[model samples]
Target chain A: MQRTTMDLWVGLFVVMGVIALMILSLKVGNLNVYNPSQSYVISGNFENIGGLKVRAPVKSAGVVVGRVTDIQFSTQTYDAVVTMSMDSRFLFPKDTFASILTSGLLGEQYIGLAAGGDEAMLKDGDKIMKTNSAMVLEELIGRFLFNKASEDDSL
Target chain B: MLLPRRLVSGIQHIGHRVIEGVWRLGVASRFFILVLLKSGTSLRRFNLVIRELYFTGVLSLIIIVVSGLFVGMVLGLQGYETLQKYGSESAVGTLVALSLVRELGPVVAALLFASRAGSAITAEIGLMKATEQLAAMGMMAVDPIARVVAPRFWSGVISMPFLAAIFSVMGVFGGYLVTVVFIGVDEGSYWSQMQSAVDFRFDIMNGFIKSCYFGVAVTAIAVFEGYDAPPTAEGVSGATTRTVVTSSLVILGLDFILTAFMFRGVS
Candidate 1:
């Protein structure tokens, strides 16, 4: 009986430890499985999203107002459609332009929204007309390097 | 002509021995898997394995937690120092999370498990074999491999992931405590950075996969050595030592291979 009780205590401690650790991870890591209440969906059309995937953050004025919830290709236009969920409180004018921006020199891509001064606020499911797709860094780098090489060759 | 012929024959013999060893290793691995599968179906053994997992994995939580805390603190302090030079101290969260998930958590937990439960398992099986208890079971028509080895393997498998998860969470908390509580990093920024830095699916999957592989390697080496232990007490002790050393090396090697494959293009 003593051994059994000891075993029971040990078992309980292990379970509680695991639970506590999991709670800490969720709290500190800020892993959000449930969507926030004050968010509405906004869509953007892009030619390329680069490495951006679903649930990527959407930043406006350098603050994360929402996240990319879905990415799909439009059948008719063959353009990549990225759906972002933004905070309802941050009203975006209908003329707001969205661009996919890299976070840093080697960082992941995020959707950056530039707010426009139009009086009309963007409603849920509204599409942003102006969109700038992800700038392919390798392409730009290659162009620069090749141009430098050609210039050296000419000289 | 005789000397040259002898040298050629010696080389040919060595080649034949190498092939034979490789063939034996292949057959041994196949037999090992077949035995595990056959014995894994026993309900009693499964229950025992679960019980052992609770003891091995759950009991080691305190050590893992404490070690994780220190590891996180050291990582944060060092990472902060380096990143501060570059004016990117805020990336401490990303660095800690990535390192803990990709490397430290699994390796630390595995090493801890090896030291704590692994030695105990080797000794227990070795003692059983040395005392002729295993032979008694065999004479009584009880398969020792099914009863003993399978349970240990399953227990190791189940416990490793649990331990790794515990290690990861504690490591993160430790990082948070040092960065936010001690260093006065903004709580919001720290958490936000961690959130943005780690994708839950990828990090968790990486940790789980590494732990599972570690589990199998550790248990297999320990049990194999124990079963194949020489008859003397000295042999049992030698097997125990070999188990720890071999398991640690294999775990480290497999970790390198897994990390290379998992992050092939990313880094």
Candidate 2:
């Protein structure tokens, strides 16, 4: 009976540990919180995605409503095309803005969605027409240097 | 400042000692392999293994939980302060979760386990040897390595992951209590943002695998030290001290190697 009691507590401890791990992975890590309804797909084009990865959060006003599903290079346009799977519950207008945003100065990149006042809502396979690429700090600095050098040359 | 003859001999002796230590390590590896084989082959010591597991694992749970909670609380408070400056205070969840899951959880848990349980295992065995209990068992036609050492080693290995898991859970709860209830960070963002940021396979499972390897290495060192210690009271105490120190250094070194290898493609 004592051995059985020990085994029961051990089993309970193991269960609790497993439960905690699931919470960490699912609730905390956001591994698989499935939406029962089917999701809608859309695509966007950006000149520079910076460090965006597939499975990155797609959020609206800091609330996550979707995930980046795929990233591809469009051969004709030489632009990075990003596909996303948005939850069925959250619907956006046709002219919603998709911007690649970093959480902090040196943090992971995610997509930020800002709603537009369009009469028509976006449908499945719709394109998010206006997309802003990630801001590149080095490129901005280089441009500033180049402009400064040109101004000096003109003088 | 030293005499030339003595200094020359000292340099030569150091060189000789390094080579001898390397050779001894190789022999220990072979002996470890034999011990591993014996552990798997033996069935008579199964009950002993269970008893050791209770002592090593069940007994060690208190220390793991308390430390894990404190560490989580500290991470939450500090992470919140840093991230709030950038107006990305919501990312505190991601910071705490990732740090615990990837690095701190396994490493800290292992360190605590080594100091608490590993040293204890070494002392217990060393005391048995000092008291000549091992010799008495040997006269009874029992293999001391199989009967005593292997069970304790195996128990230590088995206990580590469970203990680490418990520590991580307690840590997350501690983080939650601080961030959500005490600090007034948005609860939804705390959880959702963290989930979105942390990868289950790369972060969490890799930590678990790291803990498992740490378990094996620490227990092996503890058992080996106890078995090789001088059979005296001073010897047992010395061996216990060596167990904690050696296991800590080894754990830190292994954590670096594992992190380098596991996260190679990531950055």
Candidate 3:
């Protein structure tokens, strides 16, 4: 009886542990967000990909469909190259537009996709020809000031 | 001349202490390997490990749960206050979950385990040694390490990650209770935002790995201190104190090194 009681307690302990791990993975962490079972990679080139980072969400109409996998600079063209892993379930047309967008006034950045009415769909390893760069806060402010100065001159 | 002589002796004393520390570390490493080698017996018997698990893991559950909930609640309260200033109180769930999984869960749980269970293991073994129980087993041609120490060591190694996981889960729930129920944070964003922020492979797996290492380190230190304690009452007491102190310092140092490697700009 003593031995049986000990075994029962140990069994209970192990069960609790398994349950805790399940809770951590499912409820607390994003274990179910990006299923990698069927995903394809496509690269995009931008003139100035400001403040964009790898693993940033790739969203379509506010729904996340992929993740930014890699970011590199192309020395030859002086443009930033971003490789994205897109879910196979959501295919984009060849002329899809990829733009870097910030969530809030000062929050994380993500890639937004807008599909064009192209007959051809983008395949794995295909390059996204049309790309929009992230908006640099400093550059935006500088341009605003310059426009204000130009308006004053015109006045 | 006198001051110069004193300085020279002080330097010598420091050097001596360093060498002694290195030598003790070597001894501990050897003991750790021996315990590992003898662990087959514990695995084969199985019941031995279960008993130790009850003592070390089950007994520590109440404290781990209570502390985890309080820690999570505290994180929620403080995180809300800070994020509320920026009108981003919804991010409190993200903060609580990330901190608990990435650092506090494994680190704090290990610290508590080291104090509660680690000290008990050391005290038990030290008393057995003081009473010559180990020696009595040796007279019967039994390997005391394989019979006595290996079970405790394996039990600790197996139990640590579970305790840490439970702690982190409880902490997240505590945060939810405070932020969602009491503080009136939006329920949907509180969970959805956290889920988006925390990655299972990166945050959860890394935290699990950290707890496993802590378990090995804490248990190894506990058993080593107990086995090496001079067979006397004062000696046993001193060894118990040393086990807690050394385990704590090692846990913190290992945490820094692990964090530097694991979390360096991953986000």
Per DockQ, the best of the predicted structures is 3
Fnat for model 2?
0.47
Residue B13 C-alpha lDDT in model 1: 100
Candidate 3 TM-score on chain B: 0.96
- Per-residue alpha-carbon lDDT of candidate 3 for residues B1-267, written as tens digits (9 for 90 to 100): 366988999999999999999999999999999999988998998889999999999999999999999999999999999999989899899999999999999999999999999999999999999999999999999999999999999999999999999999999999999999998999999999899888887799999999999999999999999999999999999999999999999999999999998887676
iRMSD computed for candidate 1 = 3.9
Per-residue lDDT over B9-89 for candidate 2, one digit per residue giving the tens place of the 0 to 100 score: 999999999998898678768768867987963446466677777777888888999999999999999998998888888
Q: Assess the local accuracy of residue B10 in candidate 3 as a C-alpha lDDT between 0 and 100.
A: 94
Candidate 2 runs further than 4 Å off: A1-9, A34-46, A53-55, A58-107, A111-132, A137-155, B1-3, B41-45
Q: In candidate 1, which residue pairs get closer than 3 Å at backbone N, Cα or C atoms, i.e. clash?
A: none
- Best-to-worst order by lDDT is 3, 2, 1
Better of 1 and 3 by DockQ: 3
Where is the poorest 10-residue window by lDDT in model 2 chain B? B40-49
Q: Is candidate 1 or candidate 3 better by lDDT?
A: 3
With candidate 3 superimposed using the best TM-score fit, by how many Å does residue B3's alpha carbon deviate from the native?
8.8
Rank by TM-score (best first): 3, 2, 1
- What CA RMSD would you report for each candidate? 6.3, 5.7, 1.7
